[model samples]
Target: MYYAEGTHEPIIAPATFEQAKERLRKIAQQTANRKKPSRSAFSGLIRCGIICGDCGAFFGSKVWNSTSKYRRVIWRCNNKFKGEHKCETPHLYEETIKTRFVGAFNAILADKDSALENCRLMQSTLTDCSGLDAEIKSLLEEIDVVTELTKRCIAENSQTAQNQEEYAARYNGFVERYEKAKTRVEELHSIKNVRQAQADAIGAFMFEVQELDTLSEFDNKLWLTVIDTVTVHADGRMTFKFQGSTVIDA
Candidate 1:
């Protein structure tokens, strides 16, 4: 095939295109070689993706028999009996977790439209950084002015015969103001980043929700994409934390 570049401009930048290709490659690998799910399914599924309500420890998976027909997967809190204060959280079977997920996920689907609306509103609110950007701009201007003033003060001090203490005081004052403005800019940036992350999560959740009205059976890829964590309590209470921080009890 001959090189056939599009007439229009490229849709994505080179770096972003490369990153997308890499991501797809990784996903392909994970799907192709699926086998015994890892015990520490941190970014995978409910093996270590669960949190214990009692001990606040992560859950780990175990196989009852390694080489037998009676092998069964069980999940329990890692610190269930580690210390004097033992965790009372009950061990859960893999099937139990899967069944619970189906129920909870179906519940979410029942309210899919309303949840999408709420998530859209939240994403809009969180992603709008106009106010913070304005403040950052103002602070940058102040920093620039202070920086120039400090330079002028130093220059004047060098050229003219000024009182040492007075000159030092003025120079330090400008420096302190500049530093304070810089620190405030950094703080604003930090806040913006955190909010933006939340917005992204909400957007992702909304997108996934929009794709399906109901799931006939559990799809591993979709489950991992939408679910963040599962928390189980001592009294057999379970909570599913979905992407975008949406929580549901099952």
Candidate 2:
């Protein structure tokens, strides 16, 4: 709660910081203002982000029979019938999506151990920040070297009479070097933070997937935690892409 703006170097680049804020904003949107009851579990949480392959629009749920005993809901591309070219991708029954997701997940279950191992491997590689640490250190040194040289150039210029054009050119060159080094350092920091975020996501995904011993029914929590998106194609092929880059087609 104290105040210290520039007391120390930032742990992440400004871009990465902005990315974190954007992620938080999306999560808030996904979670906030849910006073109205969600007819489908996937509706409010953005838990089921199914996309249309043809039109690249997210699927939205619609009630089939709001009044009858045999009421049901289906999901289709939001712009399926809006544009000049209608989306050939068919609308999906909610139950069908659930069944297919369960079956596709079971496919991963069939290769569970290997898939888990791969997730661990990727997480391990991502969490390895030593290489980035070394690069950052070297880059910091590069910046410091450039800074000292620029300082010396300015000192020499002030003490002696010299050609103004050459002086300006040399000074500009030092400024460019300093700028490039600083930019590269910030970029490396961003990359390092992005890898760290990916590692954390994979870890969370593995935890959620591993907790499920056997999944016979659709699980909302698991769906929210593990799935990145389900792409519904024109031929009725659905691809479930899970976190950690695991894909299963059904």
Candidate 3:
């Protein structure tokens, strides 16, 4: 006969340490094999990872338990939930936004003409970098002229052929101006490359936008995948803006 450790209940004891360890391991394995509760069984489950249009914030949903049998999932702004700024919008039911997204997506995919037009609009805004080289050439010429003037002023002042104070001031001013202008030119070149990259991304998105066959099959994932943002105005009119696609209101 054996007693449980720190308990008055008597039990059969393992004859050796190895037997005790084996018994404990069996109990642990049984506990490990127990079935976990399924989380997805609830009807009104809240979906997380949704982005807010007004404050550019991400929001999550929580299930609120009540005396009633049914569970209610409330989607609240993450900022307001975290005691940040008080977002005025009421907590939206997950179904409301999901319905709106499905409807909007279906409407967009239904119109082939509109989709093609959107692609055209995006393609039109893409900048041509072919003329960038010529622009840079002109800017370099201007910098050279400014530099020559600054050098001449310095040389004349050193020879005592010009007023020292005025020549020095003028030379320094020109040098500063030339340097600023050259920096701006370099910035423009860099910007051109960035713009080209953005254009390529938009172009790829446009190609996909034009190929969509139907919108009814669109889900939340599809909406997040294609849409950049959806803006709801004060007048209750909401605009669904897509990535590299034009807005076509229904």
For every candidate, C-alpha RMSD to the true structure in Å: 8.5, 4.8, 22.8
In candidate 2, stretches whose alpha carbon ends up further than 4 angstroms from where it belongs are: 1-40, 62-73, 82-84
Q: What is the C-alpha lDDT of each candidate?
A: 0.78, 0.81, 0.58
lDDT of 3 by residue, 218-241 (tens): 353365456655554323344666
- Per-residue CA lDDT of model 1 for 84-132, tens digit only, reads 9999999998667777887888888899977777777778888888999
Clashing residue pairs, candidate 1?
none
Winner on lDDT between 1 and 3 is: 1
Q: Against the true structure, candidate 2 has what lDDT?
A: 0.81
Best candidate per TM-score, number? Answer: 2
Candidate 3 colliding pairs = none
